[model samples]
Every structure is written in structure tokens, then in C-alpha cells.
Target chain A: MDKFTVLSAVAAPLPEENIDTDKIIPARFLKTTKRTGLGVHAFDSMRYRADGSENPDFVLNQEPYRKAEILITYDNLGCGSSREHAPWALLDFGIRCVIAPSFADIFHNNCFKNGILPIVLPHDVCTQLMEDARMGGNARLTIDLPRQVVVRPDGTEVPFNVDPLRKKLLLEGLDDIGQTLQHEKEITTFEERRAQAQPWIPRIVLD
Target chain B: MAPRTLFDKIWDSHVVETLPDKTAILYIDRHLVHEVTSPQAFEGLRMSGRRLRHPDATIAVVDHNVPTSDRTQPIEEAESRNQIETLERNVKEFGVPYFPLLSARQGIVHVVGPEQGISLPGMTIVCGDSHTSTHGAMGALAFGIGTSEVEHVMATQTILQKPAKNMKVVVEGQVGPGVTAKDIMLAIIGHIGTAGGTGHVIEFAGSAIRELDMAGRMTICNMSIEAGARAGLVAPDETTFEYVRGRPFAPKGEAFDEAVAYWKTLAADEGAHYDRVVELRAEDITPVLTWGTSPETVIPVTGTVPDPASEADPGKRAQMQRMLDYMGLEAGQKIAGTPVDVVFIGSCTNSRIEDLRAAAAIAAGRKVAEGVRAMIVPGSGIVKAQAEEEGLDKVFLEAGFEWREAGCSMCLGMNPDRLTPGQRCASTSNRNFEGRQGPGGRTHLLSPAMAAAAAVTGCLTDVRELI
Candidate 1:
């Protein structure tokens, strides 16, 4: 995981709501065991035509936006599927932050784990940011994690809320497994107690 | 003692420890793995030189990319075959119990978990697939997790989590004729919108919910994800106990009695408080279908496609217009009588034996309308065998609907069973997202019986009329 701090870059605007995980990366491209190299296939259907040519109409395919490190979208973004590939693709494509009015629960959590910041703003604020994003590479947005604000191109700052622990973890680039391993003794004790209390909890017997 | 909600009881019992932050380390009792999501997690473990902490607590199956066609033949697609092979190798290396592609028990992870009695009452279950909420119907605290979390669970047998808020959805009154659990769920999503249940765990209660069988309850809980709920569950009762009693992995004899006693205590205490409460009358629900790409874009089968012009919000109107354009539907057009090219009757949401029986009952004496390709893929091999024994296969075959082996065929379109571009379908699958069936495929989600009705009529016909 990469540490996330302050990032100032061009933000692409996709005002559509309910941009599901399938749209981010279709199931067809999910066959790969490795997570890297998915940026090419990110938003595969939208980015490419049926004949495999790039769809120039897409926001990400347009000039300036093609190198965007931030995304501004509408409500319920990333609404379907729990596939972590959605965030992996975004991170692989160099998108470090997503500003939306709302987000689906699983996708929101997945973003924090992958070191991508998912910021929730009011609908009006998101619409305004989307407008600001349409100005292209000239209007770079600054996401200051330590300060917990999104700095607009016009030098305006908008505060956002994030879980304190998640925010801290993201700044340090720490993985969850390492944090969880610290409680190994407690987990072991809990398991022993549960085994005695709920002996009927079925265990897998491999053939 | 103060009253406690069902979620509170399960979550409290699973807590291994609480960090300085409010996040609790919740011990997971079961972890279900599937092909599409587990491969990367296994690779992570391998890269870190970490051993699976509890192989006995995890189970793996290949479903998403496995061909629903002849299992005897080699998989034609190299990528799909490689993905399945990767899971096989990973599971074997990790010493995790696995149901191979050919295993009679092999099916969608959610379907197989409860069928094998691995997902029981008062347990915390996690899967890489979003439909893991389906197992919550078994009175378990089950929800979906990402691959990173999957790796975390595999390494520590627990997941770091902040407890979700409690929500109670109570559906009173009996559903009218032709209204099934699918219809009820669709109605709930339509009423609540896609993000209504976000950040909360919903407990489905009331007379109508209690009246549903285990399969029906599973169907309702399965789509709770579509409503944006973290998870949904029905309290354990005689129905849930009866379903688990004779299962292969369920506790035996006296152990079963003790387990049932514990399961009985898993329900919410009387006068328990909920953070939010939503009440509905089941009688008000109708046979509903998705008219657009999103699950919440649902309307009664008798209704017309919504006109975006009527939407108050400009942003929502634009989204609706885009959905209409992609679905090739005209505003204010009738949803019923819209021609369909295909009918798919299977998925984790509605591929159990009961769902198969419902579709078969409607197809018993009718033929699939001309120009329509209808297929029934059972949920699991066990379900397939049961349907065959009950002669449902003959019914479907005679009705011109292809009866096929069990897997998540045409659900997420990971397999060869898919809708061609520009094809319209009446499907029983959970999602109706753009290209969910296949690229340029338009999906209208409904119940199995409704899908069967559409197959016979070659259109999105009202199931009540056929019944």
C-alpha cells in the first residue's frame, strides 16, 4: 500500500450516479490472479469500443483528464459488488482520491484499505467540484489528508470527515493484517473459549 | 438485563478485542471462497510467507468462471480455465477444504455455504462475493468483504470492523397471489431506493417474513445488498432449524439439540430497540421488475417505464435518461408486453430448488414462446439432482426451456452462457446493471415464476395473468 498525504492533480468529472464495480472493471478482465496491469482494463467497456479502439467520448480518454489523479462523481458511486479490483484499478490508473456525494459501503471501505481516499461531500459541493474539474489540467485540486480538506482551484477549502483510525492508517501505509496480528494472543484465547462454549460449530474435514 | 437486537448479540459475542479506536476485532466463524476473488488473496498470503491460520474454518468452490455446460469436456476458454486451476492449486496448498468443479456440492459460494451447514445460526461469515448476505438468512451475521479483507481473515481468522447501525424492516400482512419473496424484495428496494440501507444491518421481521420458508427468506436476504444494506438476516425459528437438522455438516443428535437451544437465543430480545425502523404491508407489494439498469429502478409489472421529465432532480433525471438510452426503453412505455429475447432462471439469488420448482410449475404445460431462448440452471449439483428426481427437468424440457447443470450461469456472465449484444432478457439474477448478462445486454430482473411467464409469452407479461 502507498502512503496517502497531500496530492494536487487534475480531477476528472463523471457526474453519473451508481457507477458500479462492473463498470470500473468488467468481470471478463477479472480472470487474472495478479492485481497489477489492471489499469489498462479499468473501465474496459466504457474506455474501448467493440472493435477495441479507444472511445474518445469517455472523460478519462479526453485530454488532460487522461492523466487525472482524482475523480469527481455523483451519488452512490461504486454501488455494486465487493470486488477489491475496483479500487485496485483506480489506484493502478493513478487515481488517489474520489470525491462523491455518497458511496456504497463495501467500496468505501475497500478504498481506505487500498490507500485511495474516498471523500464524501454535499451534492451541491460535488456538482461545483465537477464543474471545476471540467476546466481540465489547469484547475488542479488539492486533497490535503492531514488537514482533512479539499482545496479548490479558486483557493477555497472544503472540510470533509473520515474515520480517525482509517485516516491515520492511510497516512502511514499500514496493512490490516499487520495490525490484526498484534492481537494474536487475544484471538487465540477467544477461539479456545468459543470452542468450549460452541462445540457444535462445524469444522471443515478435507477428504 | 437490557434488551439486545439480534445483530448486537452476534456482534458482541464475536468480539476478540477492541482497539483504542472503536473498531472491534471480530472473530469470523466461517469464510467462504470463490474463484474470482480468492486467487489474489492466496497470492498475497504466498508473497508474505503467511500460513492459513485455520484451514478447517474456510471452504472454497469454483463457480463464477466455470462452464455450466459439459463438465466432462475441458474448459474451452484458457483464461477461465486458468482461474479455476489457480483456485484449485491455492486451496490444495493452503489445506483448505474445497469443492472442485466436478463436486456435486460445488455451487455459488453463498448457496453452498448454507446447504453444507457451514453457515449456521449465531456465526460470523464472510465471503469475497457480495451475495454472501444470502447466508444471513440462516441467522448468521454474514456480509461481503474485499480480497484484502479475505487475506486478513485467512491469516488471522478474524476481521477488523466497526459495528454497523441496526435497522429493522417489518413487512406485515400476507402477499397477494403471484407475489413472491422476489417481488417483496424488489418492492422494498423500490421503496427504500438503492442507498436506503447503506451503512446498516437490517433485521427483517413481521408476520409476512416469518411466514416465508427458508428458501424464500434467503431470496429476500440475498438482495439486501441491492438495497445497499451491509447485511440482512431473519431470526432463527423452526423453519431454519428444520432446514439445518439433517444437513451433512450440521451437529448430530444431542449436539443438535444443544445447538438449537443456542440458536433459539440468537433472536432479538423482546422490546429491543432499533436505530431505524421501516414498516411495510406485504399485501401492497406486486409482481415487480427492473425497468432500468439499477436495482432500485423497479416498478410493478403492470406499470410503465418512468419518464425522466417527471423527475424533480436534474441529476437523477439525467441518470434516468442515460439508463433509458442504454436499455433502449422509451419513457412512459408499458413495461409489460415488452418483447424479450431470452430468459435466465438461475443465480445465487434465486437458483435453489424452490426457485427451480417455481419456474417449473409455470412451465409445466406451456412452451417457451417462439424466438425466445429460455434456460434453467439450478443452484447446485444437489439442487440439480433433486430437481431431476422431482421430474422438474422433464417439465422444463417439454416446455422448450433448456434444463442445465448447476452453477451461476448467466448471472454475472463469467461463463459461456451469456446474452448477445442488443439482446433483452427477463432474468432471475440479482443485478440488472449495464452489460450484467453480457455486453450490450439489457436485463429486466424478476422472480422465477415471472421469468417463466415472460418466457412463455416472449415478453414481460404479468405473472398474475398466467397464474
Candidate 2:
């Protein structure tokens, strides 16, 4: 998981904007403790017809893109309710990066925290990329996680930005909990101050 | 140097400490919890072996993941059952008050909080959900936090965070016919991009806000989180005090008078200063319908789908094109009467008695469109029971719509209810993200009455016009 290497072939195309998290992984899937294997149920509705057969019309069913690691999407990606499962499912499905025009504030932040690089480009750029991916399964895109550069097959590069702090944490694989632990000394100091300031409160311990 | 606004006063007073990293340690006065996000925080606590530092300050309710179709069985789905059970266990273990499914007061946290007088002026409330900001309408500072932060607040009644700049949005003039607080909010978000409220605590004042009822004020404040603001607030005035005077949690008699006197002090001074001020005329506001994705994608019902080229700002135009392509929407199309296959009229956004009454007025003696699947999911079991008692359920069913039990139903793709793939819906829910209702499902946000109108007319139609 730390290495975060992904292939170009497993990419999928979301035809619409605001691809919400619930759609990526339904709420039922959230019951499980384990985040892995969500890929099997990812886009379950799109993958299955009313008769439960594979819908070839869906982008995931198309050849070559079936195993792609990058997903090309339109603007306002992940626009619905803030469900963390959306990013969890995307990561579970082997997608390390998503190229889109824009993203919802919460979902975009959630994706970054969970180790997915949400690449926001201009609309024309996204359209061009989506068209490229659709024209052939041979089209490839690479997101160098460490470098934060989205490298297109045509040698065109889109330089994306991330919060400097979040970028550092992502490269080091630290979540909010992990980042808090990094400031363990400061937290302890604060806790000590709190203990004295509010002596009536019990010292609650957590692992 | 100047008279402080309620927003500035609240922002300054709550800052316990400011860190080098720019996060402020703000004290929390109240914390509300629901079934979904509370479980993990509770587990995190037990794993760490910590007792809730001050359980009395926190309250828990089971709202999400409850069955909307049936009141009994703790929900048929095992996972939903487990989610509810987990809450019961956590509340028991944590010593927090719990409002279970059948409780008479059980409702959306926002509705339940203000109605019960648990949300009070000058209180800093936090919940594990975004709409937590709805409490801001009472001159309280409230916001949504994550699971880890939930645990943090449970252990310590204070949150470590950054303070926000103050934004005053003055909504002036009288509202037009059929315009509600929902339309005002939708109009606000449409004018300012979703991120417009980023890093600001928006304080709504002016004639329009002052004229709104407490319930209507809540509807406006509820969607403040949707506008990317950390929170939105209204000063405690007569309307605010009257709404809370007789609630279960409010103090009685002279105690209430004392509390009201104290609440009045929390309002902004006569010459309050604001970092940013936005003025909107209420008369100019109209019923809104979302044409594309995102809550900010909303527009006046009289408008058309914005053409990318029509946008003068090149960057904005570029962004619009991206959103359009991703949403699979064509530019320059009229938003009204766009075909819809589903109509949902309940959620935390618009599931109060007022929301139900508004939608029912539109649905009365009318039939829902043929072959269109329309459902009304009450936000809480208590609301559902009240609606049924008043025969609102019959009104909904008479309109060819299904009246379901309380839970977050079609607003999200949770529970058994969902929009079929490729189907479009005019939803009263907050978000209009693609596939938010179901896979390949298209959602267009509208007011409850608008949703009801769409259900009857079989498309995104304005109710005020139909009337």
C-alpha cells in the first residue's frame, strides 16, 4: 500500500459529473470492517443488467479499461453526500488517481487523506483526456504520486496542487490519526495543560 | 476597533488556544450524534479504554440507516440493525442520552435539537455530520467533524480547530410568492460558488432573515454546510426565543426569561464589522431548481442550463464545461420541465413538519405522474408518526406516491429505496451529485413543493407556477 503503484489499463470512464461515493460503494458495503474487496461490488449497478448480467454498455465492462488503474471523470466529481466509502471503493478498485475538471470539497479532501490523488484540470483538458481514453484502450495516463504530476500518453503534463501538509502525509502514508501522533509531544503538553485547567474532568485514556 | 458582530464575537470567544499550525482549540458546548458515524468513534474510545469525559453534554439519536418503509423490526437489513444496535450499546457504554427509533422526539438531529431547546444561543455544537451547522440558526456555533474528532470531543468537550472570518449575508426586501427559505438558500449557493463560504462563518441578517420563522430559518441554515461554509448563524431574537421557550430542554418561567435575556446579549452590536458582506434582495429571489451536479449548480426556475460559452469569465466557463461534461448535461437547455423518473421529498434538508405541509399543499388532490416512482421518507420515526396521524401519508399516497418510514431513504442511495440507473429525479435532498440516488442515477435538487410538483407533472416543474 505504501508503494502505491498502479497500471494504466484498469481505468474506467464515468460519463457524468458528481459521481457520488454511495454510487462507488453502496451503503450496504459500508457494514464490513475491511475496506478491501469493495472493487468486486464497485459500480455493481452499472456492471449488472436488470437480469443481473454484465452490461457491456457500461465503461467498466469494455475490454482493456477493465483493469485500468486511472479513472477519467468530468467536473464536480464526487459531488453528493460525504460518504468516505466512495474513495475507499475507488482505492479498493485499484485506482490511485482520478483526472477530472473539479471535485466536491469534502470528497476531494477525503480522497487525498485516503491516498488517492484527485487531479483537477481544466474542462477542455478533461474532455480531451476522456476522448483519448474512449478512442482506444491503448491510451495510458500515469500519476507519479511522489511528484504529483499527471503524465498523459501524449507527453502533455498537468501539474496538480495539493495542500503541502496533505502531500507530505500522503507520501508518508499518515492519516489524521497518524499526523496527530506526529505531534504527540504537543498533544501531551496540551493534555497536561487541560488536566490542570479542568481538574474536575477525569483523565480519559485512549490507545 | 469596531463593534463586534455575533459571528466575530463567537469566533473570538471560542478560541481556547491557537496553534502554530493555525488550528484553534475551540470549546464545544454540545455534541449531537447519530447511528452511522458514532459507532466507529465509540469503538475507538473502547479500544483506547476511555470513558466519555462528559457524557451529559452529548446526545445520541438513530436517524440514518433506519427503515423508512416499516416502523418495527429494528430494520430488516442486518447491517442497519447492527448500526442501530451499535448506537444503543455505545450510548449505554458512554452514558450519553439516546433517542431510539420509537421515541416521540426522535427526528433529524437539527430538527430535534432546536425543537427540544438543546441548541441554544452562544453554544458551540459539533456533530459527526455536516448538517450539524444547522444549529447555527440559534446564534450557536456548530459544525460537522470526523470520527477521530468525534472521539476527541467525547474525551474533551473542546475541539482543536481554526477560527473563521466573519461573513454577513444581508438578505433584504420582501420575498416573492412561492419563495421560501429553501429558495433563498438555493439562490445564495447559486450566486456564490459552493466554495464561497470556505473559511468563513456566515451570519444571515436583514429583513428577509428576520421575517422567517424559526423552522424556515433552520431550513436556510441547514444547507449552509452545503455552501462550503463551516457554519451559518442567525442572532437570537424574538422568533428564536419563542421557538425555544416551551421545549422539553428549555428552562421554565423566570429561568426561561433569564436565559432569553442572556441569549439577547449574543447578538451583533449595532455597528458590527464583517470581513465580507453580501447583499441579496428577497423579492428578486425565485423558486430554484438544480440543473446540473452540485448544490451550487442550482438556478432560478425561470433560468436555463447555463451555457459554458455564455460565462464571461474564462476560468469559470472552463469549470462549467467540466461540470457539464461530467454530469452528461448539454448547455443552454431550460431547467424547468426536464424529464424526471423519481421524486423524493424528505431528508435532513427538508423533512420537518413544515416541509411536509408545504409539499402536501402541492400534492393535495393531485396524482403523481404515471410510471414515476415517487416516495416521501420522513427524517425521523416521530415525524413519520405525526404525518400519519394528520393523514399526510394518505395525501402522499393519494398523489400516487409512497409514504415510507423514517430514515435517510432515497436522498442517499441508502436503504432499499434507490433510483433506477439512468433515471433522473427531482429530489428535495441536499446534494445533486451524479448517481447520488443510485448508480447512474441523476439527481436535480429542488424544494419539497417543487419535488411534489415534479412528481405530479412528471418532470422538474415549479409548484408556484402550477398553482
Candidate 3:
């Protein structure tokens, strides 16, 4: 996981609501065993035409926005599926932060695990950010993690809230698995106690 | 002491250690794995030189990309075949118990879990699919995790987590005929928008919820994710106990009695506090379906398509307009009479034997309307065998609905079954998202009975009228 501190980059605006994981990276592209190289397939359905050419109408297909590191969208962004590939695709495609009024629960957590920042802002604030995004290259947004604010191109700062622990993890780029492993003894003790209290909760012995 | 919710009790019992910020290292009792999500997790474990901490507690199956047609033949899609083969090799190397495509028990991971009693009361279950919430019907703390979390569980048998606030969705009174659990869930999602249950765990209660069978309860909990909640719970009771009693992997004799005793105590205590409460009358919930791409874009079967012009918010109006265009529906058109090209009656949401029976009852002695291709893909080999024994397959086959083998099939369209561009479908699957059934496939989510009604009428027909 890459450490996320402060990033200043162009943000792409997708003004739709409930842009689900299926649309982010279709199930067809989910067959890969490895996580890398999904950037080209990000938003596969909308990004490309049926003949495999770029769909000029898509925001990501446009100039300057093609290299966007932040995304601004409407409510309930990433609303369906628990597929981690959604975030993987976004990260691979250079999107590091997503600003929305709200997000689906699984996708929100998936974003953090993959080092993509999913920032929930007020609806009006997100609308403003989307407008700023529409200005293209000249309107680069700066996300300051330590200060917990999104700095606009006009030099205005809008603060946001994130879980303190998750915020720390992102700033440090710490491995969660490594952090949890430090309590290996406690996990072992819990397993032993659970075994005695509920012996039937072990393996599923199929006939 | 304050009263604890069922979710609280299960969560507290599973805590291995609590951090200062309320995040806990939670011990997972079961980890369900599928082809699409587990391969990368396994790859991560291999790359890190980590051994699976508890392979016995994990179970793997192939569903999403498996061909639902003949299992004897080779998988034609090269990428899909490689993915399945990758899982087969990974599970073998990792020593996890697996139900391969040819196994009699192989099916959708959610269905396979409960059917084999792998998901039990008072356990914490995690899978890489959002529908893992379906196991919450067993009085478990089950939710979906990302591939990173999957790898975490594989290496440590635990996950990092924070407790969600409690929410109670109380649906009172009994549903009338033609109204099923699927209808109740759709109605609930409609009442609460797609993001309504975010950051909370919903405990579905009240008289109507109690009246539902185990299968019905699973259907309700299964779509909690669709409502933006990580998990949904229905406290375990006699109904849940009865369903688990004879399952192959369930405990035997004295151990079963012991388990039931503990399970009986897993319900929310009296005077339990909830962060929020949403109430509904089951009798008021008629046969309902999704008219647009989102699950929240639902209305009763008798309602007309909504006009975006009536929406107060401009952003929402534009979104509605886009959905209306994609759905090819007029602003004020009646939803009931809309024609459909396909009818699908299977998925983790509605692929159990009970769902099959409900659809077969409607299909009995009724011919599928011309130009409508309907298919019934049973949830698993066990479900298929059970349906056949009850002659539900005969009823569906005679009614012109193709009786297919188990797997996800048209649900996610990763397999051979799919819809072409601009094909409208009446489906029993959980999601109605854009291209969820296939690229350019338009899906209308409904109950199995409703789907069958659509198949026979060649349009979206109310099951009440058909009955």
C-alpha cells in the first residue's frame, strides 16, 4: 500500500449517482489472478465503444481528465457489489481520491484497504467540487490528509471527517495484516476458549 | 447493564482484542471463498510465504464463472477456465475443503454455506461477496470483506473491524397471497433508499418477519447489502433451528441440542437500543419490482414509471432521466404491462428449493408466452436434486422454462448465460444494476413468483392477478 499524505492533481467529474462496481470494472475483466494491469479496463463499458475504441463522450476519455488522480461524483457512488476489483481498477487508473455525498459501505471500506481515499462531503460541497473538476487541468484539487481538508483551486479549504484509525493507516501506508498479527497470542487464546465453549463450530464435515 | 443487540452479542463474543479507537481484532468462525475473489488472496498469501492459519475453517467453491450447461464438457472461455483452474490449484495447495463444479454440493457460496450448516448461529462469517450477509439469517455476524481482508483471514483467521450501530426494520402483519419474502425486501429497500442502512447493522423484526420461513428470512438478509448495509440479521428461532437440524454438516444429537440452547439466547434482548428504526406493514406491501437500474428505484407492480420532471433535485432528476433512457421506459408508462425478453429465476437471492417451488407453482399448467425465453437455474446440485424429487423441474420444463444445472448463470452473466444488448429481463436476482445481467442488459428485480408471472404473460404481470 502506498502512503497517502497530500496529493494535488486534476479531478474528473462523473455527475451520475450510484455508479456501481459492475460499471467500474465489468465481471468480464474479473478473471485475472493478479491485481495489476486493470487500469485499461477501468469503466470498461463506458470508457470504450463496442468496437474497442475509446468512447469520446466519457469523462476519462477526455483531455487532462484522462490523467485525473481524483474523482468527483454524486450520491451513493460505488453502490453495488463487494468486489475489490472496483478500487483496484480505480487505483490502477490513477484515481486516488473520490469525493461524493455518500458511498456504499463495502466499496467505501474496500477503497481504504486499497489505499484509495473515499471522502464523503456534503452534497453541495460535492456539487461544487464537481464544478471545479469540470474546469479541467487549470482546476487541480489538493487533498491534505493530515489536515483533513480538501483545498480548492481558488484557495478555499473544506474540511472532512474520516475515522481516526483509518486516517492514520492511510498516512503511514501500514499493512493491516501486519498490525493484526502483533496480537497473535490473543487470537490463539480466543480460538482455544471458543473451541471449548462451542465444540460444534469447527470444520464442516461433508458426507 | 444495557441490553445488547443480537449483533452486539455475536460481535462481543468474537472479539480477540480491542484497540483504543473501538476497532477490534475479530476472530472469524467461517471464511467462504469463491473463484473470482479468492485467487488474488491466495496469491498474496503465497507471495508473503504465509501459511493458512486454519484451512479447516475455510470452504471454497466455483460459481461465478462456471458454465451452467453440461459440466462434463470443457469450459470454452479461456480466461474463465484459467480462473477456475487457478482456484482448484490454490485450494489444493492451501488444503482448504472445496466443493468443485462437479461436486453434488457445489453451488452459490451463500447457499452452499447454510445448506451444509457451515454458517451457524452465533458465528462470525466473512466472504468476499456482499451477499455473505445472507448468513446473518442464522443469527451470525456475517458481512462481506475485500480481497485484502480475505488474505488477512487466510493468514490469521481474523479481521480488523469496527462495530456498526444497530438498526431495527420492523415489518408488522402478515403478507397476503402472491406476496413473498422477496417482495418484502424490495419494499424495504424502496422505503429505505439504496444507502439507507449505511454504517449500521439491521435487525429485521416484528410479526411479519417472524412469520417467514428460514428461506424467506435468508432472502431478506441477503439484500441488506443492496440497501448499503454490510450485514442484516434475523434472530435465530425454532424456524432456524428446524432448518438446521437435519443438514449434513450440522451437529449431531446432544451437540445439536447444546447448540440450539445457545442459539436461543442469540436474539436481541428486551429493551435493546437501536440507533434507528424503520417500520412497515407487510399487508401494505404488494407485489413490487425495480423499474430502473438501482434497487431503490422500485414501485408496486401497479404503479407507473416515475417522471424525472417531478423530482425536486436537479441532480436526481438527471439521474432518473438517464435511467429512464437506458431502461427505454416512458415517464408515465405502466410498469406492469411492459414486455420482457427474458425471465431468470435463480441467484444466491432466490435459488433455494422454496424459491424453486414458488416459481414452479406459477409455471404449472401455464405455457411461457411466445418470444419470452425463461430459464430456471437451481442454486446448487442439492437444490436441483431436491426440486427434481418434488417434480418442480417437470412443471417448469412442461411450461417452456428451461431447467438448467446449478451455478450463478444469468445472475452476474460471468458464465455462458447472458442477455444481449437492449434485452429487458424480469429477474429474481438481487441486483438490477446496469449490465449486471450482461452488457447492455436491462434487469427488473422481482420475486420468483413475479418472474414466473412475467414469463407466462411475456410482460411484467402482477403475481396477484396471475394467482
Candidate 4:
């Protein structure tokens, strides 16, 4: 993945609340061991017509959103089940930033780990963004991860704040497991303490 | 300085030791395991050749892949049968207590724990599932852990942790008729915006909370994860003690009084402060329905699907369009009369006896929709047996709905009973995410009675009419 100071691309709007993880990436896709190649299956039910074609009315199938990287949604986005696959699928589908009135807990953490910025704006502000995205394909929005700014096509800039630790990890592409492992030296020292304190623990080599 | 709250007491007691780094080594009092998530953790333990630290404190059940409607026959699916078989083998080998699918104790882990009195106040619990917070209603400090974390607890009886910010979500006024705990939670989700409670432990209080039944309080605390809170709790009181008094694992006789006396000391001080406090008016809530591919995309059934275009936040608008598009819904469309094919009324969230009664009450004289498949799965084998003894099973069966055994059926598509592609379902199970039930399946989340109502009507109708 390339690091870019994201400029005005496109912002598509979907105002329904409680968009859960299953809808973001359904369960069947979950059976696969590999997390890659989930983009095609993302929102398969709604994105495709019953006849197995793209739903023209879908925001993704519409104009400027064809190249959209930023998405705006309604309240409680990513509500319901906690499936990390939701963020993985969204990231694979090219969604770099999601601005919502709110996000489900597990999904919010998943988003940050997968390098998707979930910006929570107030409900009134969310309503305004939805209108801008509804203008169709030409509606471009800029998401500058470096500056934590979500800029609108109208030259308006909205700055969002994330936990500093998480921001650094995401910028450096360090997931939770990755973050924990990055301190291999410290983890090893802790393991030594564990071996000394709870000697019953079966010794295993990390390397 | 002010005195500690119940949340602080529970959290402080669980903190075993602070590491050189700031994180705490939190000891787990009870560890709950199920078929799907447990397999890997057990495998990790086997690979490391570590005996479970305290087998007595660990409990297991076969739920996710267990069929609720027909346990009389072998699971036809090779994979499902294998998973359950593996769990049975693993439990036997490890000498761990397990609630097998056909056992009288079997059901969803969350519901089973509380009903068995396994979830107690002032205890720290961990499950390999997110809804573990469901036990918080009993005033326990509980949360879900991942596969590896599950193994860590199994080996050492503790998990690494960081302290959470405190939040108090207080609900006032009396909840009106047709407004159950489910409605209060949905309304709160709407108010707090899902992630509003992230990194926080939410204490649900005030008059309305005090009035809720045990099952209702469990339902509210169960979805705390949905609000991004690490846990949700209600201060233990008479209602809490009454529910815990005579359960199989709860204290009895002399022990009971001693437990209650100790429990009272854990209550929050009158002036204990919180990092955040969000208030909700109970009277404002009604039976709610979710229209989007998410949980927070909920509105009253009578309300129209949202028009995201009118939202002021550009970031939120784009996300809203995706939700509406993925849900195959248009802005401002009525949620009612949206036809559904499957109606599932069971999960860790709402598969308890109270939930079953609510669904059965709505189905008493109603016939299910022509093509909709409706299932009422109790939360556990005990619940199933009790319901049958009380004839609640017959009530649903006579109503043209299938009365199934207890398990985490249709909550997630880990089992054979799942929604087919593009099938719209009215599910009482939490999570309305697309394909959550199966590939390309659409889920509309609702309460047990609401799901039953949808089954009867084959559309998204409010349950108030029948209830």
C-alpha cells in the first residue's frame, strides 16, 4: 500500500444507521483462512442485483464514487456483530476513511488496525456530508491521514483526532499483534520473569 | 477523594499485578468457552502442553454449530458434526466440565452461565466471545477475549489488560408498554452513536434501569460491546440477589446471606465520578427496528429509512450511502412491510426464558408467513426443558413456528441453519450485517417478540399490535 496525502477523491453517502459487520463482509467470506480477496464479496447482497449484476442505484455503481476512497454514513455504523473481517474487506475495497455519526466498538478498533480511519462527527454534521455525497460521482472528498483532516469539495476542512498511539501504529502499519511483537525484547524479559515466578510454565522458544 | 464505585471495586480486585509497563495482569475468575472459538485456544494449550490452570473455574458448551430444531438426528453437515465431535473429544480428554448439545445444561454460553448462577457479582469473567459482557448485569467485570488470549487465561487464569475509562449511561423515567430493555438499548445506541462508549465501562443506572427484570438487564448489558464499551453493569440490588439466590451455582443458606452482605459493600458511592455520562429518557423509546446493514442504523419500525443526503458531515454521508446501497433500501422508505424469508429468535442476546416467552406470547394464535421460516431456539437445554414443561414449546409449534433446542443458532452462520444468499431475514439474533447469517443474506435485527411478529406478518411490523 502506498502512503499518500489523500486529496479530494470522492465521498459517497449512505445514511442508514446500524450497518453491521456482516453486511460489510458477510459470513461465508469468513470461512476462508486468508483475509485477502474479500473486496468482491463486500456487500454482495446490496451491491449486486438479484440477477447478479451491479445495482445501478448503489452509491458505488454511481458516478464519481466509482473511484471513491472516502465514505460517509449514518449513526452507529458497524453496529451489531464484532467481525474483524468487516474492516479487512472495507480496506481491500479501497475505503481509506469512513466518517460516521458513530461506529460499533469492535469494528472501530478493527478499522484502525486495518488503516481505515473511522471519524465520528455529530449527527447534524453527518447529515450535511450525506448531502454532499448525494451530488453523485463528481463529489470528491479529501482524507489527509497525515494531518487528520477530512476536507470537503467545498474547500471545507474537518480535523478528526485519533488516539496518538493508534495513529502512530497505523501510520507505521502496526496492528495490535504487530505492536505487541515489536517489543520482542520487553516480551522476552517478561517471559523470563514468568519462567522464574511461575516455573511450572512449559518452556518454549519464541524464535 | 470520593469512595469507589462498583465498577472500580470489581476492576481493582481483578488486577493481579502491574507489569513493568503500565498494563495489568488481570486474573480471571471464570472462563467460558464454546465450540468455535475454543478449539483454537485448546489447540494452543495442547501445543504448549500446559494443563488448564484451574479446570474447576473453566466451563464449556457446544453452541455455535449445534442445530436447534433437530438434535434427534446426527448433524448432516460433515463440518458441523466434526466441530461438535472435536469439542466433545477435547473436553473428555481435558477433564473439563462441558454442556454437550443433548445435555439438559446445553445452550448459548452467556445465557447458560447466568441461569446456572455461574455468573456472580465481584467476579472477573472472560469468554472467547464478545457478548461475555452479558454477565455484567450480575455486577461482574466481564469481557470477551481473542483466541490466543483465551489460551493465556486457560494457562494462567488471567489475561493482560489495560484499565478502561469509566462512563455512566443513566436512563430516567418509566419505560412505557411495548418498550422493553431492547428498546432502551437501541435508543441509547442512537443517542451515544455506537463508538461513543469506546474504551469505557458503562454503568446503566437510574429509575428505568432499576425497574428492568434480570433478563431485561442482561439484554441491555449484553450489547455493551455494540456501544464500544468494554463492559456494562447495573448496581447489584434486591432484583439481582433474587435472581441469584437459588440457582445451581449460587450460594445457598448461610453462604447466601454472607455473599449478599459482601456484595452490598461493592456498590458505587453516591458521589463517585465518571469520565462521561450520557442520559436517555425512557419514555421516548418504543419498539425499534434496524434498516441498515448495521446495528446503529436502527429506528422505530414506523420511521422511514434514513435520507443520508441531508446529513451535514461529508464523511458520514458517504458511509450512509454505502449502508443504504448495501441494504437495497431507498431513503425515506417505510421499514414496515419489508418482506422477510427467515425469522430467527435466539442468540446469546435474547434466547433466555423471558425472551422465549415474549416470542411465544406473540405467536399464540398467529400463523407464520407463507414462505418465512421461523425458529424459536431457547438459550439452553435447561431453558428448552423448562419451556416444554411449561408448554411454551407447544405455543410456538401451534403457531406454525419451529421450536428448537438451545444453542447459538442463526446468530452467526457457523452452523448448518443459515440464510441463503439474498434472503432477507427478521432475526432476533444480534447483528444485522449483510451475510451475517450466510452468504449474501440480509438481516434485520429485532427483539424476540418483534421477530415473531415479523414471522407472522412476513414483514417488518411492530410487535405492539400483537403483544
Chain A TM-scores of each predicted structure, in the order given, are 0.98, 0.82, 0.97, 0.83
List runs of model 4 lying over 4 Å from the truth. A1-26, A29-207
Q: Is model 1 an incorrect, acceptable, medium or high docking prediction?
A: high
- Which prediction has more favorable DockQ, 1 or 4? 1
A197, model 2: CA deviation in Å?
15
lDDT of 4 by residue, B125-190 (tens): 888678898999998988876555666777777666678888999999997777778878877877
lDDT of 1 by residue, B311-399 (tens): 99888898899899999999999999999999999999999999998998888899999999999998998899899999999999999
State each model's CA lDDT, in order.
0.92, 0.75, 0.92, 0.77
RMSD of each: 1.0, 5.7, 1.2, 7.0
The two-chain DockQ for each candidate, comma-separated, is 0.83, 0.14, 0.75, 0.14
- In candidate 2, which residue ranges exceed 4 Å CA deviation? A1-28, A33-80, A90-207, B270-273, B306-335, B385-394, B397-400
Evaluation by TM-score, superior candidate among 3 and 4: 3
Task: Evaluate model 3 with DockQ and give the value.
Answer: 0.75
Candidate 4, residues A17-42, lDDT tens digits: the string is: 66666667666555433345777877
DockQ of 2: 0.14
Error of 2 at A126 (Å): 11
Question: Over the stretch B127-225, how does candidate 3's per-residue lDDT look in tens digits?
Answer: 999899999998898999989999999999999888999999999998999999999999999999888999999999999999999899999999999
Q: Candidate 1 residues A68-136, lDDT tens each?
A: 999999889898899999999998998999999999999999999899999999989998999999987
How well does each candidate superpose onto the true structure, as a TM-score? Answer: 0.99, 0.79, 0.98, 0.77
Docking class of 4: incorrect
